[model samples]
Target: MLRRTAPCTQAPTTGTVLAGSLWHEAADPVTRRPGGPYGPLREPDVNGVALPEGFTSRIVARTGRRIGGVLWHPAPDGGACFPDGDGWIYVSNSEAPLLGGASAIRFGPGGAVVDAYRVLSGTNLNRAGGRTPWNSWLSCEEILRGRVFECDPYGSRAAMPRLAMGRFRHEAVSCDPDRGVVYLTEDEPDGCFYRFRPAYWGDLTSGVLEVLCATSDRGPVTWRRVPDPGGARAATRDQVGDAKHFSGGRGCHYADGLCLFATGGDDRVWAYDAERERLEVAYDAGAPPAAAEAVTPSGDLYVTRDGGDMEIDLITPDRVVTPVLRISGHPGSEITGPALSPGGDRLYFSSKRGPRGDASGTDGVTYEVTGPFRR
Candidate 1:
């Protein structure tokens, strides 16, 4: 998810009324290429990463390794970078069963690791989450009856579980600052897209959880309150009468006026127009199975594959798709957490299972790719 500390100048009454204001269109002339904007990949680097020319890769942390005193967590999943005083902090989630929690790595202004610490603990399967406008990170759990935990990126405040966000197998979340709501995705085969309308902007203590309702795939959608967000009796997705079902929802991203998400089971990328209250398929075919997604300042989209060749594909504003980077020799591992640095020059992600390629995820690796990315 993208992180923004800037406050909205004009608050919209609801997400639907202000959704159109966030829609962005690229104007710069793009040179169409068969490979990608940066061109074809060279040979594999020392870190077993293949990138285009003028781009480089470096390993930041490995599973069970020591970084700034504490041992790095295994199975680094979804992560986001927040702007610190001089540099920034990147927080990553561990997908390990009982040990699943989140850790953070603070960097210096020159992009050097200064500190590493734990942010959230005693959680299960900390899958993916979004960055709030208030400079906090929402770490989601992907399990039956899972909940969303709001963690302080500075490691100052205790992680709090926002029960109002609903109880389900969460995949990721995206925050719409203008509407004071956060969009959430589930990883079930019949998952539903949802939004949590907080009682007040910048607060998540109390809120009305809603699921998207539409009569058709391309919809003039509406929001219906989830009668039971806690899922005490029935799962939140089933509480709504006509809640639209999304197959394997993951990697949700919200920008100017659009919320884009990917469903791995259906192999489609869906875009919801907040202002127009319309839903449309952005990319349906001829791409890898999408899991985690991130957006650049220039409106370009980057999506990571769930399992297939361990690659991260880039989708241009013009709808051109190409592989930006691919991991070599990591057969069973998948790419996760494709987030950009605060400066928008370095890309950070991890190989979930790493070299061991076992289901235990005991040997994960996190790397950073630097290049002249389109800002």
Candidate 2:
């Protein structure tokens, strides 16, 4: 079993802590043995998927295929569902190096595709990102000295690159509306966790980027402002010597005063109590590979598998772990972007390499799994 309790050793305080004296409840590991709830998965359906009996999946879009008039971009990743009036919009990122950008599919009230369009272009290697409280999508670039593009999910406004958010191999981000800060994760072996304190609450045009620093793994942490966020003088990760290194930081999600992030290098999900200024390991073993994560209305977390048999596992608020769905014959592909619809009845994700398992992900397939999800 992973260590549930670690003495939090406080590091020497330097500068003003952004979180100040605010503190919240200590975090507990959400990992638990499987088969605790939801029972076992049924046999594969017609779509070659195994679900919890009541759920069904359908292919919503395919690579090099037309949804409306636009061709669905290949290698779809990092998606978020936004409420669009009576319907909702699902925005997904394109992980193509040269043709990197983002696209969106608008769904009607009855969960039918109303339209499809591209919202961002001229970017590179668009990876995982997060949705803001204001309904905008933060499309991140996974490249050297990359950037975060704030995109409009409705595809009405133009996407803007948030240059002040620091330059690194960004994987995903999460917005803490209460603190007016946007947390970011880098995708390197020795990457550092970061947060952007915007000049204004909702504006990303300018901000003070800070890196997390601590003396121990599960200890009190401090936020140190990065001297140069642009990486013109030195790389953002090397700017601060004492910044905590998170091996291959991948997914990040902020909810209920806790920021949960996954580090793929170690296959661990860590929870940070921003208010309490403490960190804890949420899931270390006997859990999913811990790639991208999406939280449901009932507080259950859906984590996509980074490798192996393609599947998405659900971690309930009470700590039971179970498989939500599994995709067969896609061994070379990993699941990406497990996002819930605004109504919370449908889940959206993608098989990054499709059935053929191409390295370029040119034959990716986007899927929709509908079921009696908790509201």
Candidate 3:
């Protein structure tokens, strides 16, 4: 099992870490034996999905369904959970080819969608993104020449672009609240791992964008700044002279003082220790990974499979990868987003093209699986 590092001296006031620390509880491999923390999954009682023995899944929202006077956005991708009054707010990204953006769904008691609406609009190919320490969503546009937009989860505010975060085919982001730094992943075959240090901590309007350059897999690394944050004329990698190239960067999550990121082309997960200035491989699945992933409060990593017997694989602190949930019927669809609730009892994700691989974006569905997860 990975050893625990010293906690950040500066306390975080926003994001998932503040919602509830996933590091407080340690996962017991024995308990995760036959099934996992919850138990062996049983055939879904409702949505045709499956989960660990005591878990239950419900369709929270579906594509083409009109809610809050708008069609529930399709191609649901990366998402994050934020604290609400007594429940929580789930902000989901819609990676539609056109008219792509983000949507918000408020869950009250008993995991019910009290309200849902479009939080971001007028963007092209909104893909995977992460939540900020300030309680906002960084909606990424996956186009070759795209930018990151900060959207309000409440849908009351307009989406703003943070050009300083760099213009690239962004896939995911993970924020280090205490240090006030944000890690971003590019989705290109030879993409680079980047970190944005805002001029003023917690402010994304201006920052220095730097790419990682490590001599070894485990490293005492260095960073090289991107000549241009707005990749209008050239990509960030082309501008950064010494940027280290990664393979098809995808999902990223921050937990236990480490920034964990995945690369689909490499089928590997990597961990970066910002404080220690080190990088290490966490897991190599030997196959292309799903577009989204989530880490439990207890430090377990869950990655969805891109194809071929779709399943959500669990990686323990000891780096043991096991298939926990097998997604049935979604032949050509990829499991896009996998997000855990603030309380750590619920898991939320979406099937990109829905069960039958519908190309019209009308068959996508967002689901919530509630169960006894390690807190």
lDDT per model, in order?
A: 0.78, 0.77, 0.72
Across 68-146, the per-residue lDDT of candidate 1 in tens digits comes to 8568888999888877876888889999898898999988888899999999999999887877767788899999989
Per-prediction backbone clash count: 5, 1, 4
Q: Cα RMSD for candidate 2?
A: 6.9
Q: Give TM-scores for every candidate, taking all chains together and pairing residue i with residue i.
A: 0.91, 0.91, 0.88
What are the per-residue Cα lDDT tens digits for candidate 2 across 201-267? 8899998999999988787999999999999989999999999998888877766566778888887
lDDT of 3 by residue, 1-375 (tens): 111111111121222231212222222221223454545667756576867776778888889887655678878877777777778778888888878999988888677778888888889888788777677888999988688999988777899999899988988887886577889889999998999999997679998999998767666789888888887788888886667788888877665576767787767767787677777776555454564366554556676776655677675655455666767788878776777776677888888888878775668988888777654
Off by over 4 Å in 3: 1-34, 288-292
Tell me which residue pairs clash in candidate 3: 22-297, 40-53, 41-51, 41-52
Question: lDDT for model 3, on a 0 to 1 scale?
Answer: 0.72
Rate residue 290 of model 1 by lDDT.
Answer: 53
Judging by lDDT, tell me the better candidate of 2 and 3: 2
